[model samples]
Target: MQTCKILQDISALQVLSINISRRCFYTTTTTSPLPWLFVGLGNPGEKYQGTRHNVGFDMIDVLAKSHGISMDRVHCKAIFGQGLISDVPVFLAKPQTYMNLSGESAGPLAAYYKLPLSRIVAFFDDMNLPCGVLRLQDKGGNGRHKGVRSLIHHFRGNSEFARLRIGIGRPPGQMDPKAFLLQKFNATARERIDVGLQEGVGALKLLASRGLTESARCFNKEQKYKHIRVQTLET
Candidate 1:
């Protein structure tokens, strides 16, 4: 009788251990949804406003206004705001660490939020693309953009973060690229950029509601075909 009682107690203990193990497995495998981080790269200061290089900053402003995300706080070396888009939490940041050192702000924001690279999207100017054109890409090399280079460096060499590349076009003949970047767009280009910003807001909303892949597929296709027509007209 004593041996039988001991066996029954042992069996109970084993069952309890199995239940605990199952709970642990469930806790480890299940995760809540993570927020998205949208970072705009540009130099901060009144002087840089409206310049080609500051399009990223302009984009942030447009997004904040459209979504009612108040960028009224300074955090992680950036002008920061948080709000919901389609009930999904989203963070918007404009790095105040200047363009080349954007990572100083971006890296800490990601770490603080414990976000993966896939959940982060950066907005910045791209000279390789024609003015008024935009590109959304999941991952790529920095393409010699200083702000992007800094981000890659701070991400521990990880370059998998998505980007919304706003085109400002290349410098015209014999003009210094640096000089052009700091120049305000002429009237024609300014009109194009304004139109582009509105379009960008739509694309971003789609991104938040649907997802990166779907948003990119729809946005990029329209932009590609539209730009092709524009180029043909100019030529």
Candidate 2:
């Protein structure tokens, strides 16, 4: 998973701003206004696909399917597509820089499109809640998430952007959280994830129509009553 190497690189560049490789992520034919940039965080390659850590990627796939987003172009170290959601133009991205350097892929894309931090929505897995429970927060601290910490650093310490948090539950027994993130979901977990992903699809639509506050309130309220178990992560 290159997890060790990513950790080393993060430490080396902890205080330094390094040049990132350029990628051609944009090929939009939209004459309409740019819709919100929805970035799904995950590692690249087959081993990572369908794993708990790739829930963001899975959500991107769901959104693209429901909204006709092709995700045909690879740029900025991500594969993305432009499509309309209920008449709103939106860009979907799945970053290819593993997981720890997601900010490197997202920051440049934001600059490329001249989009403000407020216009971006980051969707990633969260370990705090049971599987299938989602948290929609306007802004908050990274809670020590390494990928999110990287984004905060790259954004010049700004953490005001919108976030769509999907719960993946905690590790079982004493298993390493890192290992848990890479493992694919079990059958029972997948059954529940399908439900959560449907909610996530609805949540994204709500974000496009309703503002962030209303959307968060609409989705987060369900978590209080629903007791679900699932696995996912965003580090």
Candidate 3:
């Protein structure tokens, strides 16, 4: 599995307003009234597929599948595709650079589209929460995530972006963070993730068609699955 880590925390509240790139690509096809750039944050390559940290990629895959779009090509140093949800143009991207350089790919893409960070939403994993949970925030701190840090850097200190954090839970016992994120989810974890991915796609649909505030209010902090423990008395 592919693994990487970032060494700093970036607060979205401290974004700057400069260095915006000048490139824009328009989708002639009409899908939705609002156009957005959706970025799925994760390392690139086949080895990382199915890992807990790749949940962002997984969510994008789920959304593309639902829209009958295939993410099978490279563009802007990432895999990307275009599709419309409720007449809104959505550019889906999976950064080619490893997680730490995710912003390098995303920043240019957003700037090229003439879109503000506000229209750009990133999906990524969060270790502070329990597995199978999802959080949607209009704007906030990066929580020390490498990909988000890089993105903030690329934006030159812009924090108006939307972020969707999927919980992968804390590492087991004292397992290394790198190792834990690289590990595949167990059967139960996969089931929970599958359902969560579906929910994530629905949230994306809402975010693209509706608005961030509406989408966050509807799906943020909502869990698609619940964990129930069964105990048996000693016999």
Find the candidate with the highest TM-score and give its number. Answer: 1
- Whole-model lDDT per candidate: 0.91, 0.81, 0.79
The lowest-lDDT stretch of 10 consecutive residues in candidate 3 is 226-235
- Evaluated against the true structure, the overall lDDT of model 3 is 0.79
How many residue-pair clashes does candidate 1 contain?
0
Tens-place lDDT digits, model 1, residues 40-128? 99998989999999999999999899889999999999999998777667899999999999999999999987889999999999998
24-88: candidate 3 lDDT, tens digit per residue: 23433344254688899887778998998899888888888999877877878889988787667
lDDT of 2: 0.81
Ranking by TM-score: 1, 2, 3
Preferred candidate (lDDT higher): 1 or 3: 1
Model 1 alpha-carbon drift over 4 Å, by segment: 1-32
lDDT of 1: 0.91
TM-score of 1: 0.86
Clashes of each: 0, 3, 10
Give per-model TM-scores.
0.86, 0.81, 0.81
Cα RMSD to the true fold for all candidates:
6.3, 15.2, 15.0
